[model samples]
Target: MLKIQEIREIIKLIDQSSINEFTFEQDGSKIKMKKQSQEVETVVRNVVAAPPVEVVSTQPQPVPTQQPVQEASAPKTEETKADTSNLHKITSPMVGTFYAASSPEAGNYVSVGSKVTNDTVVCIVEAMKLFNEIEAEVKGEIVEILAENGQLVEYGQPLFLVKPE
Candidate 1:
């Protein structure tokens, strides 16, 4: 488990560093963190593994006992439904690896709450060994960032959410 202080430190580093993406692997766990650009939108994929269960009885359980299990799964279904409609997506113009900054040593083009105009260079998508600058098509304030830096982004994949100004 990550400590609160460590998480805070990570956030601070992200705020201060020019690099937009960072990944760390420790113990048996891995974490990838990225700062999104103002004009781009991103999609987050979460895969949760089911917890291990111990069987106390070899016999089949009664129908009545399964009622609680069915009820518990309902919340997960509702959460998925809630997330479906709450997004404003910014899609990629090409297939490539999404980058928030020009390079690992450079500052990111944008961050959450950043303002952008129609011509703002929001991010760089590397395709066929070439770096392509992605621009915002509309003026807005960045509300959410969707993709992680250095991650493979498909064509038309969302990169950011912008609240129109």
Candidate 2:
């Protein structure tokens, strides 16, 4: 791990250099420092689950057959809100990963057309290893779930659209 003094030195070096950003990675720790117009931004993330790399292969290999699933729903969610402005939206209060259930094996807290009270927990948002239960403050039936399961949601991003009864 890099020391605080080392980080300070790096920041000082970045300030002196012509480069606007600096990034370094060692083992599983990654650090990114960027200079914005108003301030300096620093982001850090640790990824610890990598297998050991020992052998080098010279032969050409075929690409993996499994395809990645990308969620193309953010724009559609915006369109949905625009189309139905009468509905009440349950937006996220913080940036986190949206989860429909408490656990992977559990049922979703709320689904489309599901009746909900003001105190109902409609979803869970996990931020920095903490799971936060999100509530539906409006008394209504859930009309649409704007975010997909396990999707990353930003602050004020709509999670559910509800139609008041």
Candidate 3:
């Protein structure tokens, strides 16, 4: 196993150099680091699972009784659905937490009515501590943002709707 100081030095050297990826293996342990051209860096590690915990809720749940209200909104829902039926969906490439911006202080990459090109980065998805940038694959204006910031998204789930130009 590499000592703490040695590991720190290796990380410093990798950061100073232009290498995109570095890997080292000794015995049964492995270490890998990857640097993104967009300034994202990820350190991959093995994770161990902990025992599960059981929780019991005692709070009473409220029952919903809004059938009439739902019926009244059905037509409006259908109309809204029909309007977006022609828009293209930008689906997630992997399961991860969706982020509207690179950082909390940063502005959102895209919002409703925002224009995007094929290579435009629309959002960031974080899975296993690695932040993956998701791009807009079509040239269009964003019609909707389906996922909320920090919300967990599943693979192939639609994240945005875009009206193609």
lDDT of 3 by residue, 15-127 (tens): 54445688877754456766654442434343335443322212222332444634643566677889888899999998777999999999999999999999999999997
Each model's lDDT comes to: 0.67, 0.77, 0.76
TM-score (all chains, Cα) for each model: 0.49, 0.56, 0.55
lDDT of 1: 0.67
Task: Please provide, for model 1 over 26-129, each residue's C-alpha lDDT reduced to its tens digit, 9 standing for 90 to 100.
Answer: 65444555656521111122324655332221122122233353464366667765764564567899877799999899999999998998889999999767
Give stretches of model 2 more than 4 Å off: 2-30, 34-83
Candidate 1 versus the native: TM-score?
0.49
Cα displacement (angstroms), candidate 3, residue 96, comes to 0.8
Q: Judged by lDDT against the true structure, how good is candidate 3?
A: 0.76
Q: What lDDT is reached at residue 20 by model 3?
A: 67
Cα lDDT of candidate 2 equals: 0.77
Order of candidates by lDDT, top first? 2, 3, 1
